[model samples]
Target: MKPGRPAAGSSHWLFTEDRLREEVTESQPALLPLDAWHRARGGRMVPFAGYEMPVQYEGIMAEHLWTRESAGLFDVSHMGQLVFSGDGADAELEKLLPGDVRALKAGRMRYSLLLNEAGGILDDLMITRLPEGHPFGEAGADDLYMVVNGAVKFDDIGTLREHVADRITINHMEDRALLALQGPKAVDALARLVPGVADLVFMRAGAFDWQGVPLWISRSGYTGEDGFEISLPGDAATVFTDALLEQPEVKPIGLGARDSLRLEAGLPLYGHDLDPEITPVTADLGFALSKRRREERGFAGADHILAERENGAVARRVGLIIDGRQPVREGADVLDGEGSMVGRVTSGGVAPSVGKPIAMAYVPVAMAAPGTAITVSQRGKVHHATVAAMPFVPHRYVRAGA
Candidate 1:
C-alpha cells in the first residue's frame, strides 16, 4: 500500500531498486555479512526483510536463465537458522508443527508449517534433525534445526517460545550465514569444493568442515533445483563464496531471479502466497501434513485442517496461465465467468523459464480444476487466463523422486 511500490504482497516481493532502497534506507536496515562483497560484484542492492540485500546482479532474466542451465549462488543469510534443544525436543515440536517429528529419521528434513490453533499458517519452514551422534555446537545430537522466513523470524520465535514448554530452548543462530547453490550443475561445483557433499540426497542434511570452519549442509533450496544450502560461520562466507565463484559454473544471483525461479517452480513464498488466513489445504500444501500426524490429530490446528482435508476447502490455490504477453502482478482480482470477484492472485509474473505469464491464485474449489476458465483484473485491464497445473516449468531437483 505504499505509494509507487508494487503491491507484490510480501515485503520480499517485487521491487524497483530505487524505491526499495529509498524506503528501507530510512529504517537503517542491517547489512548482511557479505554486504561489502555484494557491492564489489556490481549487485544492485535493495532493502528486503530488514536487510540491505541484492535484488539483481547481471539482471533478473539473465541470472534466472543461467541458474536454470548452470549454477547460481544466493546469499540467503537473512533467513533465520534456529536450533531447538532440550528434553523431549521431538515430541515438543510435534505439538506445533503439522509434520511427524517423531517419525523423522536422523539427518533428514521435511517441509512443514507453523500453524496457529485455527490451522492458519503463521509461517512455512523446514525442520531437520541432526544426524545421529552429530552435534551442532553446544547443542546435542538430538537437537533440531529449523530454517524460517527472515521477514517473520521474530514472530516465529515468539510463537515457539510461547507454545513450547520451558525445557525447550530456541537458539537463534544469527551469527551464521546461509548460502544456497542451485541448478543442475550445482553438484559439480560443490563437490569439487566439499568432496562428500555429493552424497547428500534431497531433503537430507549433514555436518561437514570447510577449511577448518564447520558447515551444516542440506541438499535443499528455495529454487526447486538440485542444490544445497550451506550454514557456516559468517566470517567464512566470503572465502567460501570466493572459492565457489572460482568454479566455471557458479555465479552470484540476486533476489529478482530468486523470486522468478521459485514462482516458476510453483513454490509459494511465505507472507505472499501464505499467511494467517491461509491453511495448508487452502494453500495446496497438504503434503506437508504427514500421514501419521493426520491420523493422530495432535498438532495445533489439526481439527480445522483435518476437516478441510476430508470435506475439501472452499477455496484452494491453483495455477493460472495468462493468455497475454504482459505479466500479472499480485493483488490482481480473480473473477468468475459471471464477473464477480471470487479470489485473488498471490504470486505471479512472466515466468522466465516457461516463457509465459504464470500465477498462483485462490479460487472456488468448483473452479479449481485444470482447464477451467478464469478472469484476472489488474490495473483496470481484464485479462483471460486458464487454470492449469503448476510448476509452469518442471522442477529439476536432484533425486526428487528418490
Candidate 2:
C-alpha cells in the first residue's frame, strides 16, 4: 500500500487497496523540513497526510524487524503540536474531552479523544502537562501540550478555537518537528545523546536541551515497544536525525514499516480503525474516557457515549489472524460461517514482526471474542481467519521504574 490515503485521528497513514494510488496521482503534497534529508537517505517518498513522506527507507520488512530487535528512528514531523494555556486550563479542556484533565500531573501524558456533540470521535490525541518551568518561553505555567493527527489538524484547531479560544491561548507549534525512536534498544541508543532521557517512565514527559536546542521528550510511542517521541525545533530535525542514525542500533524507518509495526502492536490508524461515526466504546478505547469522566458524563457527546459505555456498543473492534501469506487489506468483508457479513476489515496488512497477516475490524460483540472463527472476503476470494487477541506482539512499555 502506498501512502497518501486519508489517515484518521492518530498520526499513522492508511493504505486503502485501490483508491490510494489513484487519489495520490491527483493530489499535490507539501514537503516537510526534512524532505531533502529523507531523499538523500534513499527514502521512497510518497504523498501522505498532505505531505511528502518516506514510506520506506531500506525496506518495510527490514525496517520493521530492525526496530523489533534494535532501534528505528521514525520521522513523524507531520503531526500537529499544539499548546493550550490559561488560568483554568484543565477545567476548560475537560469540557471538550472525556478524560479527567485535572488529574493530569505535570510531566505526565494521557491519550484522549476529541468528540462531537453526537458522541462520535472527532479525533484521537495525546495530551501532556508541561513542567511548571517554561524553559523555551513557548508556554507558561498553566499550559498543556497536545499532539494531534496532521491530516485533521487544521480542522481540529478550528474546532478547538471555536470552543476554547476565548478562554485559553492555543499555540500551534508549526516550527517544531516530532521523532520517534522505538524498539528494545531504543533507550540504550537515546540515552547516549541525552543521558537523563532513560530516567523518564512511560507516558512521562519533560523538557531537556540537546546542546542549545530544547526538546520536549516523552517516554511513549505507538509501536507497543519501549520508545520515545521527541519534539524539537523543525530546523534541528535533520541534525538530530543524523545524530541518532550515527548510533549503530538506530536506523531510519518509514511509513510502511511504521504501519506494519503498529498493526502488529494492535494500534489503530485513525481514518481506518477510527472515524467520526465510531464512538470510543466501539473503537475499544473505552479506557481513554477515564473513570471520573465516565461517572460524571461531562464531556461532549456524553449522553450517547455514556449510554454505550453502560450498556454496550453495537459492534466492537477486534483482531484477526489470517491463515495464509496473502495479506488482507482494508475494505474486505468479514463473514460468519453461513457467509453472512459480520464485519469489515479496517486496517489489514502483512505484519513483519509477527510474520503473519494480521488485521483489525469491527464485528458484532457476540463474535468479537478471541478464538472465534471468521472468514474474510477479499477480491472475490474467501480466506479463513480467526478473531485473535490484539497486540499479536506484546507491548514492552516501560513502567514507573525498571
Candidate 3:
C-alpha cells in the first residue's frame, strides 16, 4: 500500500492521487477521452486501471452527499463494455455465469458474477440482453451486452474466449465511454435531456438516441441509488457530461466519493471485497446465483458452491459498525471475544453518509450474525464494533410504483 493510503482488500483499490500519479507518470498511462475536459475543470488526475482519470473535483465528502441528495456524474470509461452475440449467446453465458440467462427478457439487466472452476469469482459484471430486434452496431439483437471492471477486463475476455465455443462472437466496445448519473433526482435531471428516461425501471435498459448521439442506457448503478449508466460514443462523452452538469441537480463526481458511496450502500468493491479466492456464498452474494441455475448445477464450481450454499460457508462477508469516531482501515485484524484473530477487514472507512465508521469483513459463519461482537486492531489500537446489517444506509433504488 502507498503511504497515507488505505490498504483495502480485493481488486478494489484505494489510491492516493500523488502516489497514483507518481507511479503512472513514469509509465505514460493512457488518458481518457475526456482527459483534457476534466483537467480544465479542476479534476485531479490519477492513474487507475491504466487510465488517467479524476479522483475528485470538489471533494469526496461533498460529492458523496450531493449524489445522495441530488445527482452526480461520474466518468467510468475505464470499464470495458463487451457485446456477445450468436444464437446461443444466453446458453454460452450460462456456462460461464450461474445466472438464469436463458430466461432473461429483452431490455432487462442482471447482476452476475463470472466464476472460475472453483466457484471463486473472476469478476462481478452487469449483463443486459439487448431488446429483440435492437442491434448494437454490428452485433445482432440477440447479443448480450456486458460491462466488466477495467482492471480485469482483459483476463475476463480471455477466459470467456477460452471457455465459450467458436460461434459466439465477442466484440469489445472499446470506442465507447460509460458514465453514471446517480442520486434521487437523477431521473428528473436525465429526463430533461432524454425524454422517457424516467420510465426505465430499476434493472431495465434500452437503446435511445439523445441529440443525435446513440446511447445504451441501463437504470443501474454502483452507488445503490436510483440512477442510470449511459454508454455513448467516446467522442460524445465530454459534450454529454457537460450537458448533464448544466442541470442544478447534477455535479461531477470522482472515484473517491464513488468508493464511499458504494461502501455505505453495502456494495462490495470487486478487488477489495471479492477476489479469485472468494466464492459467491462467502461474499454474501448468493443472490447472483439464480435459483434455477442452482438446481441445474451446470455452471463452473457448481458442485462446491451448491454444497456450501446448502451446508453454509466457513466464513461470510458482513458489515461492521465501529463504536468510535476513528475509522478503521483495511487489513486490520478482527478478533473474537477471546481476542484470537478470526478474520481481517477487507474494506472500511468513514462513511460520510452514515456519519460513522463502517467496514466490511469476513468472519466465521458462527460469528457472521448481526449483533455479533468483534474487535478490530489497527495501528496498535483496539476498537469495538458490532456485526450489522449492510447498506449501513438503506438503499434507495427506485422500484416501479414506489
lDDT values, one for every candidate: 0.86, 0.84, 0.86
Candidate with better TM-score, 1 vs 2: 1
Candidate 3's TM-score = 0.94
Clashing pairs in 1: none
> Model 1: per-residue lDDT, tens digit, 1-402?
101123443332244454344334355888899999999999988788889899989888899999999999999999999988887888998989999887778888999999999999999999998765553577575789999998899999999999899988899989899999999999999999898999888999998887887889999998978999999999889999999999999999998899889988889988778998899999999999999999889999999999999999999888999997876777788888788888888877777778888888888899999999889988778989999998778877667456
Lowest summed lDDT window (length 10), candidate 1: 1-10
TM-score of each: 0.94, 0.93, 0.94
True-vs-predicted CA distance for residue 161, candidate 2, Å: 1.1
- Give the lDDT of residue 323 in candidate 3: 92
Residue 238 CA displacement from its true place in model 1, Å = 0.6
- List model 3 lDDT by residue over 1-402, tens digit each: 111234543322333453344333356778888899999999988888788899999888889999999999999998999999898889988888999988888898899999999989999999988875553686475788999998789999999999998999999988889999999999999999999888889999998888899898889999989899999999999898899989999999998889889999999887778888899999999899898999888999999899999999989999999998877777788887787788878878788888888889888899999999888888678989999998789888877788
Off by over 4 Å in 3: 1-27, 133-135
